[model samples]
Target: MAKTFAIVVGESSGDQLGAPLIKELKKRYPDAKFIGIGGEKMIAEGFESLFDMERLSVMGLFEVLSRLPELLKIRKTLKNHFLQNPPDVYIGIDAPDFNLPLARMLKAHGIKTMHYVCPSVWAWREKRVEKIKKSVDSMLCLLPFEVEFCQKHQLNATFVGHTLADKIPLEKQTLQAREKLKLNVDAPVLCMMPGSRQSEIKRMAPLFIQSVNKIAQSIENLFVLIPVSSEKREKQLQEYLVEASFKYQIIKQDSISALSAANVALITSGTAALEAMLCKTPMVVSYKANALTYKIISKMLTIDYVSLPNIIANREIIKELLQDDATEQNIVNAVLILMGKNEQLRQIELFTQMHRSLIAQADIQAVNAIDSLLLSK
Candidate 1:
């Protein structure tokens, strides 16, 4: 008899994590069936996607509220489907907003539940710990710090390390990356990652472009590389690019190459900042949200920094400018500071250490953890 695994992943980063795990799981259970929400990568690895992953890829409290009806509809559909035909194990790979409730409901029905990428209980909504205990049968975490946190809370959690750390090399080939991207080897390169989502690009692109304009005025030949996550985002950024007066190139769906080739980066806070850190690129992280959303969520945050690099280091390794503070002037100042040799070298040294701590053969460990959960059942 074969096993069935239902995995749900909401965004691109989750998809990246899910794809490799699916491949490894397939190798372990040749006849296993995987079906759920995922992006291109997971689909390519023979996972059946029930819904377009983008439907649940929303961020910000206000944004989620706006789409609440639709999101609820999808969740209800998923819940009813699983109730009718439950898999052996349900793996919710991030998207805690949607996944947690779905996992809890399925768990009540006696289906084993595994949640990959533990939500930031240490950061905010510590009350979520109680819900997580009730919802997840086993939790697989990416950060080293999270394992201890989970243990303290008496949750069954395993640290699988970060898949990005496994994929990004310790010594990045910047020169070769520049050459491959047809960029000038000696010129200053700035990777502008507004974000992967349409809403994020809409909020941050203009601000990043304005900041780059300021930097361009000072630097002789600054080259900007904007990595668009999709054709829709490319077109969305193109609309914003029409107003820019600086030299820039748009590379579709290749954030790693852009990060590798960058001397510094101006990124909207999220996984892109983490990717920038892995590439050892100095960066100034910035983010914006709907005004009411920022006000409400900001009050609940327990941590100081937003970027993963800073959060992992437990210090302000990278400057995080948010909401009102994420101004053009602030971004320009941060970028200029990063342009200095001493600052760049310090960041790179710290980034190398962070990278070393996170290389833990994630896919294999994740599968092993999941297998343990299955055996206990």
Candidate 2:
């Protein structure tokens, strides 16, 4: 009989990361039924999605609140369906908020569960490690440190490395990206990515655009590339950039290329900062969140660094200008410094070292972990 693997992934990044695992699993079990919530990439690999993946793409605390009923209904529906006919193993990729509870429900009913991508328990809410222990049989972490956290809690975990690391070249591969983007390879090019989320765009766009405007006023012939995740985001960023007197291009759905092509990147914190690091591009990571949220989170966080580049190195490799310090002057000075060959070379060397550490056949590692979980019972 063919095995069944139920996989749930939220957002495009999750989908991108999940696709390779699904492909590897298929290679091992040709007739296995791959079903759950996935995006286009997973669909291309013949995985069946029960509901529109966008249903789970809700962002922000307020946005999730508005969609709470629908989200709950979907989870309940999945819970009922799986209880009636459980898969051999269920895997939740990212979306810890949505996936962990569902995994917990399924696991309680004697179903095997695994989660890809460890949550932010390392940064804050360390008690969540206990909650996660009850949910999944194992965790497939993208970073080495996450596995260390999981080990401390005695949670079954593997450091599969980051899919971004696997995809991005280990060596500095900027020239080709610059050529493809039709950029002046010698001239200073800056990538300003505010982030993909609606909440991120709203909070950071003004600050980023104002910074770009001020930077452009002082610097000569500086070209900016802003990569938007969606058409909606493109429209939103266009409004912000139009008001700013800067030479910029609004590109859609090509964040990695933008990061690679630029001499220096002024970006919002999170995956993009990681991506910039993988691209071997120097960057200044910045973020601005709601005041009350920041205040509460500031107290909760255990770590000093925010960007993954800095966190991975266990030191401040890149400059992080966050919240109150994320001003135009600070960004301008940081960007100027990063544009210099000496500073750029320093970051690129460190980035290359980190990248080398992260390119460990992640897909195979993830599937092997899943296979072990499947075999245990």
Candidate 3:
């Protein structure tokens, strides 16, 4: 008999993480029935999504409230589907708010549950660990430090390494990527990645746009590449660029190419920072949230750092300007400081080691962890 596995991911990032895991699980169970909510990548891998993945992509605490009724309806539907036809195991990849609650409901009914990523409870609310403990049978962690936290809390978790680090080559392909992007081999190139979401573009895009002019005033022949995730985001940024004059291109969603070809990157603090680190690009990271959200998160945050590269290294390898400090001048100054100081070489040297440390063939290990869960059940 073929096995059935249900997987749920909250956003595009989780989709990226899910694709390879699905591929490997197929290798492990050739006739397995895979079902859940996913996006393009997972669909391409032959996974059936019961609902559109974008419905659960909203971020921030207050932002989720407006969509609560629709969300609850979807959540109830998922719970009912899994309860009626329980899979051998259900894997929730991030979106702890949605996934954990669903996992709790399913786990209570004798269904095995697994959570792919460890939530940032160590950094934010330590109380969340209890929710996770009751919700998941095991956690597959991407970062090394997260395993220690899971162990301290006595949860079944594995350090499966990061898929991005495994996917990105340790050797920098700067010249090849530059040639493909039609960028100057020696000219200073800046990749401005404000964010994938419109709310983030509204907040960070203007600062990045202003910084380009200021950065060009100091460095000769400066070129900027803004890799917008969607056409709507491109149109939104076009409005911002209507008043400014700069050497730039609104490239559509080849962030890896943008990061690889650039001499330096100005990015938001999150997974993008880790992507930059894996690509061996030096970056100045920044983040901003609404006043109320920032106020609440700022007080609850237990750690000093925001970017994953810095958090993993346990030191400030890259500069982070967040909240009230994310200004145009600070962006320009940080960019200039990085370029003027020749920071890429130092950052790349450390990034190579970090990449080596994280490339553990994650997809295979994650599947192994899942197989282990099956045996225990």
Candidate 4:
């Protein structure tokens, strides 16, 4: 008989992380079955999903509140399904809003529950720690700082290192990427990552395009590159660009290539910022949430900076313009400073040093930790 495991991954980043994790989990139990909410990548990894995971990829408190009844229905369906055909373990990959409640419900039904990514407890609403302590049998955290925080709260947490450390190539690996893209070797390139979500594109794209206009007016021989994560997102991004009449190359399926080939990036905060650091590209990070949600959470957040690079470094190494501050002029100014000789050198040094601190054998370490947890139970 083979061990059965059911995993729920929500959204693209979670799906990406879950696919590799499922491969690792399968190495331990070859016939393990993955089920629940997930995107295309998880489906490709033999995971049977309940619905299109993209539908649950919402952010901001207000955005989620409006869809509360629907979210509850999905959770109820998942909870009942797991109870009917319980697995040895249930792993919820990110999407804390959706995943946490499901984990709690399953754990109540005597199912072993785990959350792969720790919510930003250190950042805000530390009260969530109480719920996390009750819901999860264990939490697998990507950041080193989170381990200490988890331990202090008596939560079972492991520092699995960052998955990007295993995925991103450390060597000087850009010229080939540039050559493949056919980008000008002499010109300075800037990658504009407005965001992956449709609402985010609507919020940030116009400002991002306007900043491009500013840069184009001021700087000569500068090129802008945009990497779209999905075909739907690419089409939406193109619409935004066309509406604004901004000319730029939209690179599909080669995000790493675009990141490596760029001098600096004007980006929305998330995994992409970390990817930029791995690719040796400095960035000006920006983000905006729905008005009511932003207003409420902005007051509660304890952290000073928004970008992961800045958060891990314990200082603002790169510029961050968030919400109303995330204007075209501010973005253009930050990128201009990044383009300077001295500032550019400093940013590279910061990324190189940060990379040195984060690179551990993350995948193997994570799998071993998960195995240990299973054995302990």
Best by lDDT: 1
Clashes in predicted model 2? 0
Give the candidates in order of lDDT, highest first: 1, 3, 2, 4
Give the number of the best model, judged by TM-score: 1
Q: Candidate 1: lDDT over CA atoms?
A: 0.91
Instruction: Name the candidate, 3 or 4, with the larger lDDT value.
Output: 3
State the lDDT of candidate 1 residue by residue for 243-264, as single tens digits: 7878999887678899999999
Candidate 4, which ten residues in sequence have the lowest lDDT sum? 239-248
Please, what is the whole-model Cα lDDT of each candidate in the order they appear?
Answer: 0.91, 0.87, 0.88, 0.82
Enumerate clash totals for all models, in the order shown.
0, 0, 0, 0
lDDT of 2 by residue, 1-377 (tens): 89999999877678878788888999999999998999878988999999977678766556677899999999999899888889999999999999999999999999999999899899999999998999999999989889988999999999999877888888777798888888888877899988776668888899888888888877789999998766776887777776778888877777888888888999988778888999998999989777766787789999999899888888998999988898889988888778789999999999999999998899999988988998897
| lDDT tens digits, residue span 183-217, model 4 | 88878888899887777888889889888888877
The model with the greater lDDT, 2 or 4, is: 2
Rank the candidate models, highest TM-score first.
1, 4, 3, 2
Q: How well does candidate 3 score on lDDT at residue 252?
A: 71
* TM-score (C-alpha, index-matched) for candidate 4: 0.95
Better of 1 and 4 by lDDT: 1
